[model samples]
Target: MTYWQMRLALLRHPISAALAAVNQSGLFVVAIMGTALPAVFFLILLNFGILLDATQPSPSRLPILLHLILLQLLLIGLMRDAILGSKARLLLISVPGHQADHKVSMLLATLVNPLLWPPLFILLSTSPTNWPLMGAQWLLPVLLLGIQWSGLFAPAPSLVYLSLIFLLSLLPLSQPMATWLLSEQGMITLLLMLLLCQKLPIRTLFNRLQRLLSHLPLPVSSYIAQSVIRQELHGLVLRLTLALMIVAAGHLVQTQVAQFSGEVQTLTVSLLAVIAASWQLPLNRFLSAKREFLLSLPQSKICRATLLGQPLLLGLLLFQFWLHHGEHCWLQIGLLIMQISLIQIVTIRAERQFVLASLISTCAAMVLFVTLAN
Candidate 1:
């Protein structure tokens, strides 16, 4: 009873919640098949390694690998919430030696995390012969466990973890001097730093920043936009990651696969745009619920537009960077606009409806993409 409850509590942690959101979004099957965005991202990294040296592995990839590990830590921090619910907290804390039990439960949750398994499985399968790289890759999960365990006792905001991860990621940029930073000794040192982070005045620093932001005389829309972005951050990051992976895959196909037609490439990109636009459904609902209050504010039209355009702007920037090399730049941008506009028409009301709408919208977008590409 205690074990399962503890496991459930750990499973509800922010890291798991984001993944759950993905699963609810109808990508659970893709995740199970190990073809998910995280897996593709890792494979892309390996492809980069291959580009560096088709004959022999390169050590330069180590720094980037560290960066990915740091990313995982940052994700945990971003999605983090209270580790235990009120009832679970009361029940679990009453168990004798509950700390040990909680650690064990956390370990189980970390292993079973769907978002993590794909990348870790890819690393193990591909690098069995390369023990050094394999060992280095395995450190990601360990670091995840360590950071999450720390969160169980002392939860810090994502910004604090991001700052620490950023500082650590920069340590490997100098190559020769920084190689030792990823070594076994270096990993132990990093773990110590992770533990020591609990000692920082994280709550105080976070509060000060929030208070400063609140005091600023910002428009109602800008303020709401910030709040909505923070609230939807987990899902937003997941969707953007999916979009980027699709874009990267399309880039790889275009560059490497000559037999694949332009129509197919465009279809892939259109699907990417649709994935990017999926976040807007939730964004619309979030705003719609507050419609009455927002209308009460002055310049509400401008605020509403600004709030709504935030997601689209992010999608535009991503596509712009991806499509800058193309000849028909304006045409491609138009196609992207059509793709986003098309998906926004399909609203999400329930799980089944969302799945149905997503499939129908994606197919429609693909047809649109293929037609435009020709």
Candidate 2:
């Protein structure tokens, strides 16, 4: 493919797959939104309070700057696979000028990021007075992309760069400096300056880190599981964040709402269990992609199960702690575990048809929740 064609393909493939997944799991989407929407609203209201408080003239830029960093980090994580995946690596090796092309394509892709731009525009709309600060925030994802590249190519420099940025943000800037920092043109200049400061051989540093990791003595199952988690660490982190949000929200509601129904609390616990176990989707996808190769190895089944079970077991322990006060907590826990285990198994067998499997699993979980609540 030509460079443009390759870029288009890279950009279009994920969108197409996401649409297909969405079409396959309309019910899944509804279920997730239903479970997550209340907590999401709570977060928005909470953040709105903070936003109102921070909207003063000469507001402390730290929180807004920190918000920029958080949003950029999330954007980088969501797009990491596309930006640095196997296809990108292959393109870099095979296509002339692919280094520049790939970087440009990834940057262009981030332009449409649901996680990054929407919130930014929303913030801009809400806080029109802080337009300059919002303008400065636009360059952050670019800066973060550079940091991601640095981490991939030169880990040490990336750390230094992050520390420097953090320190600079903490320092009090004079009015002129602050104005310049918040200006789009000046922020771009600053970004370029910082990029120039990181003079390190990225590949050499990354290879060294790889060599160091290679020597770690881990059990086979642990090593394999860790590898999968590392590969999809960003997505896993987001899932964990969502899971935590659900648990926290649920806990808050349970403690504060005297009129909270037992059925709703039980359903919340059930949803928490499902969310925790949903890590299996990515894990199973990874394993299923390598299924033939893995099946050829001795004791592969044990390794696969161990890879799948470890997270579930840990999640179960957490659920037990969280639910110890509930009526028939053990029974609820047992049903939740069974529902999650069933979902995981079904997802594994469904192979590349993960979306369909997810829909089925979601339906199964809802049924289990209803039964338990009754």
Candidate 3:
């Protein structure tokens, strides 16, 4: 097929169509923000940079570079799903042409993408010192852009090979030799060379990764239940756990900073109560499902069973908390239990309305609490 024909085929694919829609909307917003905000920020940064430089040591530049590298790694990690999507591979393999022709065609197709140029501009603008390594730096963007385009059409076999190369690249090498080579020619050249070697290998690697994910012998319903419970409980448990741990660690800091005994006690008790309440949140869905199933049987009343389950779940949660933390703060715990029961009733009446109202109220309450607590 001709290059244009291959491009046309890519556009017709389902994944491409969905991605195009998302890209169109994203590009419009991004373009607007990119134009308006950067100018304002650059002017602010120019003034701030002078003041910051006067106060901060020159050695701070290393930390700034490290932060930039970490941020880039995070961004690249987030984009992995978009890179690995099935549509990407279809586009890569669709061109019935030579390797160089495929590479060039894919590169051209990528350049047409609105997402490609902005990052290239940002990379060039931010690290002008590295511009002396222009030949190597240019290759990084080109290779990345090409890889992104090819990944959409890369076969399953190619993905597997790519994964192996990625793993291999993580191994530690001779530090002095590596540093000498990287510093002399620049790290981008090394990155590009490594990427080029893995290009053909990725198709095989991806198939293995796909099979591994697909063949994992986990029940979907059980997994979903576990995930839901984890997500629901995470905010409460993680926050409370971390807060308590930090409080313990920073006891001396708190004392030195003027400790408020009443506030500390109240906040600690409130967090414990909140964590207790969170346990029943997942039980709402479980009880609701059970109620529905039981109502279909010969002798169960849905309303009675659901009402009974609420108290039973609440009691169980209270007992669990009591066992862990003891019965010292019963009043606040009782209030939390009542609040959770009420939430469950409201949730059953109209979940969407209840959830929206609860979220708004929770946010407002949190703001008020933080303001007052401080």
Candidate 4:
């Protein structure tokens, strides 16, 4: 098969495609949230020092803003590589795809997607004079992505690149540099880096991984476990890390001053992550697919019982986080209960209408959340 055909086939892989479709709905939820001033303000408060806080003398939005930008960049980067990718697909590409010439498609996959550019545009629209930093912004991540893509054969790339972003998170930049990194320039630089990383004999390594994934029972178990962890576990880690990093950055800026107490904001952010992650259950996919044997009425009742049990289980766990962090834990706990149930029920009911179900469920939950806020 030709290379383009191979790449398309890989993108069509079930796990990657299904998750991408779900995330698309999640992104829709985000855009809707952006329209609410209170939601946006509250989110900024979670990460950023309020620009007008009268009590703190040494306050600036720069650190928090920069951290926010970097966190989003890291998230979208991983989504491009991981949620939208499968090792099996990459393996197929590496075999029949192209050894050295796959750079163009790789670049396209990274930079030329639907939801990325508008955010990049908004970020860049801030300042036209800070163009060089823009280039650096894209370059830094792409370079890291390249290093990451190259090392994906072994375990080194992900750790190394994550470490690199973590270290970069600790660095302080001037306003202009920060502005540049916040724009399309940053996105391009990161994409090009991934393209460069494809210079390796990825096909050969992919063939090896594919073989390993298929042959031994141990390998099979590992892949299955990896799939579950990637789908369920680290999904929370991704958002939680963003919250923690922002809190950490805010703390660093405030250490020189004694007046700042950002604990409430930090706590709010942590809870925010917990709530967001709870909504990522695979209920829609579960109900939509008939790949498994059909449940009898009794069996369906048991399964529904288990599904209803999810919100309770999630609430208890989230309560532990909320109990330590902030007030209104009960309110959020109640909100989570409603949100999960609505999401799960809507997803199941709208089984084949995955997108419509998520959109309706999310909007309904958001309305309830806003009502509670008022």
Best by TM-score: 1
- Arranged by TM-score with the best first, the candidates are 1, 2, 4, 3
- After superposing candidate 3 on the true structure, give the runs of residues whose Cα lies further than 4 Å from its correct spot: 1-109, 122-139, 155-186, 189-369
Top of the candidates by lDDT: 1
TM-score for each candidate, following the candidate numbering: 0.63, 0.50, 0.34, 0.40
Per-residue alpha-carbon lDDT of candidate 2 for residues 124-145, written as tens digits (9 for 90 to 100):
5665676564665556545555
Clashing pairs in 4: 94-203, 134-180, 137-186, 138-186, 138-189, 138-190, 139-189, 142-190, 142-193
Ranking by lDDT: 1, 2, 4, 3
In order, candidate lDDTs are 0.58, 0.56, 0.41, 0.45
Q: List runs of model 4 lying over 4 Å from the truth.
A: 1-20, 23-97, 101-333, 345-374
lDDT of 3: 0.41
Predicted candidate 1 versus true structure: per-residue lDDT over 1-374, tens digit per residue? 56556546555675556667777665442233345557666556554443323243234444344444444554444444433433355666776657676556465546544446655555656745775645544565576667666655555643465567655544424555445555556667767777677678887887899899889997777887878888877677666555544554555555555555455455555566666666666677777798898899888889888875765676686665455323445665676676665555554334345446556665676566556656
Put down candidate 3 lDDT per residue, 15-120, tens digits, no spaces. 3553453233222221223356676345324322421232433232222222222222322232333333324556656555534554554554454443345446
The model with the greater TM-score, 1 or 3, is 1
- Candidate 1 accuracy as TM-score: 0.63
Regions of candidate 1 where Cα sits further than 4 Å from its true position: 4-67, 74-87, 114-201, 230-234, 237-271, 317-334, 345-374
**Deviation in angstroms for 209 in model 1?**
2.5
Which digits, one per residue and each the tens of the lDDT, describe model 4 over residues 205-286?
A: 7689889867766523233334444555445444444444445433444454434333333333333433443444553343
